[model samples]
Target: MTASPEQIEIALESKAWPFQEAQKLVERLKKFGNPKGYVLFETGYGPSGLPHIGTFGEVLRTTMVRHAFEFISDVPTRLIAFSDDMDGFRKVPGNLPNQDMLQQHLGLPLTQVPDPFGTHESFAHHNNDRLCKFLDSFGFDYEFKSATEAYKSGEMDVTLLCMLEHYDKIMRVILPTLGEERQKTYSPFLPICPRTGRVLQVPILERDLAAGTVTYRDEETGKLVEVPVTGGHCKAQWKADWAMRWVALGVDYEMAGKDLIESVKLSSAIARILGAQPPEGFNYELFLDENGQKISKSKGNGLSMEDWLRYGTPESLALYMFQSPRKAKKLYFDVIPKAVDDYLTSLAAFPEQEGKEKYGNPVWHIHSGTPPREELPVSFSLLLNLVSASNAHDKETLWGYISAYAPDIRAEDHPLLDKLVEYALVYYEDFVKPTKKYRAPTATEIAALEDLIRELEALPEDAAAGEFQTAVFSVGKAHHYENLRDWFRALYEILLGQQQGPRMGSFIALYGRDKTIDLIRKAIENPRV
Candidate 1:
C-alpha cells in the first residue's frame, strides 16, 4: 500500500533534524513580518571542475526540504544554486592536461581561465555548465546564478560596501584563521582585474559610488593603488564576502560539508555585526572513496555525478545521497544495486492512500526522511546479465524469480520490486553498456567453474528449497570447499566471469532454468585460456 500525501508530510516532518541554527534564523525572520509564505534554499558551486556526488547530495537535500515545505504549507518554496565562476583559480584540478595553462591563469578570475578540454571558453564555465546539466537531469527546480553575472548586474555592490565598512573586523577574523606563514602574505581579499589579468590590490579608500571607483593604498609597500571598478565586476575578499553575500541574497538555509563548518561559523558572526540574517546551516559529511579517504578532485579520487549516473539510476543515486551524511562512509560501484533494491522496498512499504498523491505524500515523505537500508542491489554487472537474459518485463516478475531461489527475499511482503526494476534499467543503460561485449568466461577458470556446476547438477531438481540448499552445501563440504567464501568465489567465476556476482541461488532462480543452464554452458564452452 502507498502512503497518502498528508502522511508523507507527517513522516518527513517527523524526520527533520532539529537544526537549532535554522530555528534561530526562522525566529529572526519572524521579526521581518514572518515573510508571508516562502522557503528559500541556496547551494553554492565552485567551478573548479566536475561536480562530484557530494555536490548532488547538497542540492538534492535542499530539494527535499523544498518539497517538504510545499507539502506542509500553502506558501511557495524556491531554491537557488549559485556558481562561483567569478572566483580566481586557486589550483588546477589534477584531471586537466595542461598544468602550464593554470599557472598562466593563476590569480585570474575563473571566467578568464582557458578550458583544458578546449570544449568551453573557460574552465569555470565548463564545470558550471556540466553541473547545471546534472541538476536539470535530476529535475531540481533551481535558479542558476553565475558570480560573474551577479557582479556585473551591480547586485553585489551593497554587500561589497558592507565588507569594506567592516574590513578591520574581517581581517581580524581572517588573519587568525590562516597559518602564520599565509597571514604574512595574504590580504583580506584578492579582487581580480580582467584587463590586466592580475589580482588588483584594493586598499581602504573613500567610495565614490557615483563614478564607480575606489581608491586605496597598498598595505605592504604603502604605495597607492587606485582602480575604476566596473559596475558588474568588483571582487570581494573570500571570508568577509561570503558572509555578506548570504545576508544580501536572503538565503534561508544552506548545507555545507564538514570542512567548511568553521568558516561558516565565522561568517555567521559577520552577519550579526552587519545586522543581516544569516542562513540556517547544516554540515554534512563527505563521500569517501573505496580506499576510505575523502573523495577530492585534487586527489583524483572523486567520482563525477555523470559517471555514477552511468552506473545507476537517478533515484538510486538519490538513495545513495539519502544514506547518513553525518557519518563518514565509502561508496563504491558495487554498492549501487543494493541501494536500488532498498529504495524500491521503501517505496513499496508506503500505504496505497499515500501513493495516490503526486507530490508531498506522507508515505514518500517518510521514505525520503529515513536512511536507506544497509542492503543494496546484488551487483550492477550481475543484474545487467539477469535483465539481459530474463523474459520478465516488470519488477514483480523479476523479484518473484529472485524470491523463488533466495530465502532472504520474502515473497509475500516485499514492496520495492518496482523501484528495483527502475534501477536495473538504469544500471543496464549506464554501467552495463560498456561491458556488453565481454564473453562469460574461459578455460583458465574452469576448475572452480566446473565444481560449482557439478554441485548444482547433483542437487535434486524436485527437492524442497531447504533440502536443495542443504544438498548444495553438502557438495561444497565433500569437495573440501574452505567455506561459503570459496564456494561463492567459484560460483562467481563460473557465472559472471568475474570475482563476484549476486547470491547464487537467487541469481540462478531469477535467470530461470533455461537461461541459467545456457549461461553455465556458455561459460564452460568459452572458458578463458
Candidate 2:
C-alpha cells in the first residue's frame, strides 16, 4: 500500500535504515528533477563466479530500500541487477571443472570465454544465468542488465564518449591512486583486442576526442592501434566502469560492501566528472565465514544460499540480511536458528505495530507493507531442541509433539511451523547430532534433577510453561544453585546434549512433562561421555 502523506511524514521521522535511505532519494529528487520519471536502484554483479550469499544480500537490501521508497513517494522505481560480463577473465576459479581450458582463455572477456560447466554459451553466461535464476527464485522484481550487452548494444556509448572527452581529467583522477607501474598503464578505457578478443589494460598513447577513440599499443602485435570508445570496442576499468554505468543508466541508488568505501568514493568522483550525480549508496559491512574471515566468492568458504535454505526458511535468511546491515556478522550454519527465531519475533510483532512503528519493523519493508498473517506458535530454535530430544527423523513425529502441546494448532493451519519441523529434523541430524556430547551429572546435579522430577510429578499433565518455569525456578533456588545458570546449564548439557538450548519451560511443556522426567532419569543413570 502507498503510504499516506501523514505516514510519509512519520516515515521521514522513522529511524529504519530503508526509510532513511528512501528519504535521501526523496531529497535527491527534490534537488535534481527526476528526468527519467522513475528512480533506478541498481545492484552490480561480477559474473566471474557463481553468485554467492553476499550477492543475494546486496540485491535484497537494495530491493528493501526500493520498496520503502515506493511507500513514501508517488514516483515509480526500477531495480536493475547489473552484471559485469564484459570484464576480463583474469583467473580460473578453483571450484569449476576443466581448469586447464579456463586457463587457456584467461585474458579474454568473460562472455567470449567458453563455459567450463558446459551449461551456457560462455563462462559469464553460465554465471549470469545462475545469477538470474538465483534472483528469480527469490521473486525479486528486477530487470537484468549485462555489461557486455550494454557495451555491445550502444547503451553505454554516451558515457564512453563522455569519458573519452574528459580523458585527461579522468587520468588525473585515477593515476595518482595507482602504483607507479600501474599508473603507467592505467587508462579509464580498456580496449577489446580486435584479434584475440581479450580486454587490454595498456596505456592510452593518445586520445582523439573528435573521433571518440583512444590509441593504445596492442600487446600481441606490439603496434599502436586506435579503437572507438563507443560500442563494443572498449570498456572502462572497474572503478570508472562503475561510475560510467551509474550515469549511463541514471541509477539513483546502489549499495556495496564496506570494503568498497574507497571504490565508492572514486566512482562517485568519476560520476561527478562525467556530469551526473552518483547514486545514493549504502556501504554495508561484509559477511564473515565460520572462522570469521571475510567471505570470498573464490574461496567458497561461507554459507551459500543453498546451505542456509537447506535448514532455514527464506524469511529467516531475509531476516539475517535485514538486521544490523552495517555490523559485521558471521554467516554460517550456527547462526541460522537465531535468524529464524528473530524473523518469527518480527513477524509476530508486525500486527501490533502502529504508524511509524510499523515502518520501523523489518517485516513491513520485507513484504512491502503487506506482511502475511501466518502465525508460528513455536520458534525454529524450539523445534530444533524438540528434534534433538525426541530423536525425531520426520515431521510426523514432531507434529505429534506439536499437536500435544498446542492442540488447537494443526499442521494444515501453521504451514510455516510444519516446514520448520522438517528443517529442524534435518538440522539436528546434520549439524546438531554429531556435535552432541552428553555427560553424567554430578551428585549435586542429580539431587537437583530428582527435586525437579518431584515438582513435575506434582503438576498436572496440561500445565502451562509459566507453571513449569515456576517449578523449575523453585527447585533451582531450593537446591542452592548459586548462579542458577549452572542449574539450567546442567539441564541442557545433561538432557539436551548441547551447550545451548531452548527455554526449559517451553521445551518441557512441548516435549511433555513425563517425557522430560524420563530423559532426566536416563541421563542420571547413564555415562554418555
- Highest lDDT against the true fold, candidate: 2
- Could you tell me the lDDT of residue 400 within candidate 2? 95
Q: In candidate 1, what are the lDDT values of residues 15-52, reduced to their tens digit?
A: 54422233444454566644536667899887776677
lDDT tens digits, residue span 136-201, model 2: 998999999999999999999988899888878888998889999999889988988888888888
**Which numbered prediction scores highest in TM-score against the true structure?**
2
Model 2 lDDT-worst window of ten: 520-529
In candidate 2, list every pair of residues with a backbone clash: none
lDDT of predicted model 1: 0.64
Query: How does residue 424 of candidate 2 score in lDDT?
Result: 90
Q: What is the TM-score of each candidate against the true structure?
A: 0.72, 0.98
lDDT of all predictions: 0.64, 0.90
Q: At residue 206, what lDDT does model 1 achieve?
A: 52
Model 1 — which ten-residue stretch has the worst lDDT?
A: 354-363
Give the CA lDDT, 0 to 100, for residue 396 in model 1: 67
